[model samples]
Target: MKSPLLAIMLALSAAFPAVADVLKIKKDAPKQYVVKKGDTLWDISGIYLDEPWLWPELWQMNPQIDNPHLIYPGDALALIYDADGNPRLVINKAYRKLSPQGRITPKGTNAITTLPLEMIKPYISYEQAIDSDDIKDMPYVLGANENTKTQTLGHILYVKGDLKVHKAYAIYHEGEPYTDLETGEVLATRASYVGMARAFRTGDEQNGVPSSLRVESVKREIQQGDFLMPAMQGQLLPAYFNIHRPDNAVSGHVIASPRQVREFSTMDVVVLNLGRDQLIEPGHVLDLERQSPTVIDGPRGPRYPEDSSKFEKLLSDASQLFGDESDEENTTWTMPKEKVGELIVFKVYDKVSYALITKNQHPIRIGDIAVIH
Candidate 1:
């Protein structure tokens, strides 16, 4: 007889026929595998299914698992079949033990993530998109110790603005402005990260005094007139999240990249025009496509005056075969857009969001179109 948990999984599998049909297993998938350090959920899922983004469906079928999103290192995953022969991936169960509270807990180290955190942690912790109005009021570096123009780690600086005593802050230099390709409207400006500092003394506006601060670290040289904002603390991001297509139809373009490169590929962080206003959020996956250039189908070579009449006669004959002479002269052909890559949105602002490229067939450009998969 099947166990109660297995029976429940089999029943759930029967209920969702469409999901079972779509969740296809790879022919060469292993019967069992162990989670290891540095292994991501996407990498693990790709080993079992063709569409790795459908990983959540596997856990949905087996509701007995505890915290399906928190799979940790050393845990064992087994590929099992239900009564109807539909494959399901489940924790070995033997690797988990009941605690004093009677809760199943996997014996392992830190939980695995959906993507490599190191690649995106800097962008999350240090950088941000801000409105143009906000930049006007932010505190800026008034002067540095020793009367220098630039300051580095361990240098003292004076800031002219509102600041609290012993508060941590991140230094930033205003970068390029993101704009809408269609309307030419400015969306948001990027606050490029410079370094970090801690306020030692608060400034008094009545006395015309500037706050005293000491630089703690530097990624770039902190110069006079650079701005400061509260430093982000702790790992506020989720350890694991599922990838899925957006529910509503959405389309946008890659407007910018933090690295400021012309072409992007897998693992590169990119900025997209779609954001909270468009209902775009973290874990939403979008497909990339490159539009083809239009080409003229008319004459390829120059015509001499001697052959002008002959060429005109030939053009007239061709126009008669195709359409009007004016129409033929203006006709241009464009090829279908080519599918390039995929990206997953991880950070969102008001009118823009940041996405990490997850896959690519060709190099993705700045103006490439992103649409719902």
Candidate 2:
């Protein structure tokens, strides 16, 4: 059997056809595009190609840019091909260098953030996983605009906790409760949708006490007792990445789904049970699997191998039919797990990673096992 690495390479070959069969470039795509501030890799790729994920296939990195992937505003990208005749996009700028105290001052921070941070901001930043013990310590809504209990967009929210003024936070309402299937332990209730608030004032040592925040926006009701967590905008990174199979085979599970739903479809995000500690990282492709079915042992009422037709075989069949329980009655039958889909890890945390369903043969749902493909 071909190793996953080999398989991935073969897939790229199959995906890349002749020069004429290369991924279609957007008709409106500029032959040369200047990297702009606020531009995401995903957005940039989409601007130039029909399928953005295939950017790596056609991205021709210019060695001089320090890191070709780190394109900055004012940097130019042009479509070109190497002597091998494969089409690619490269940064269209002359290679330049800088000394610690060089005449050319270091340009402003041009480091590219991978993902469109705004899109996943709510998931990575505001969404809080809390336990019952955490309730007291977490920042909670004390009240809203005008000392009255209600809150709305642009309304001031007074929260009781140590919150820094002018910092953004996500408001969360306690969500549906989940019980551990095995331990029967009731995990903390889900942190539900509430809204976003940016703290503009926090009580000082004497005059001011509670922190004050302005309601930026909300998905659900922005009310009292809502939880607040630091907006983790940095968690989101470049979404457009080259896909690779893990070097080692490892198995894990889909622990959660978008909106914490049990079922999900393609393009939905999935929380995985594996993370960096397990050698899992962004771009790793994992195959979704299901547990083999468990089968029950039936009564042994004189059953034997079908080939037992002759007298000699009949004797053996009789002996087998009468076999008594020796872990025999408890023996289980099962089939290999079904591969339902394929997912690529997009973001990885400490104990969990987020993966996006890239391909599915069946509806991808929770609890399906995921192993490095």
Q: Pick the candidate with the highest TM-score.
A: 1
CA lDDT scores, all candidates in order: 0.75, 0.62
Model 1: lDDT of residue 131: 82
User: Ten residues in a row with the worst lDDT in model 1?
Assistant: 1-10
| Model 1 per-residue lDDT at 106 | 45
Number of clashing residue pairs, candidate 2: 7
Model 2 — TM-score against the truth?
0.57
Clashing pairs in 2: 114-237, 114-238, 115-237, 115-238, 125-232, 166-199, 203-208
* Candidate 1: clashing pairs of residues: none
Write candidate 1's Cα lDDT for 260-373 as tens digits. Answer: 998998989999999999999887878999887644444653333344455555664565567775445533444688878888888888999989898899999989999974
TM-scores of the models, in the order given:
0.80, 0.57
**Displacement of the residue 276 alpha carbon in candidate 1, Å:** 1.3
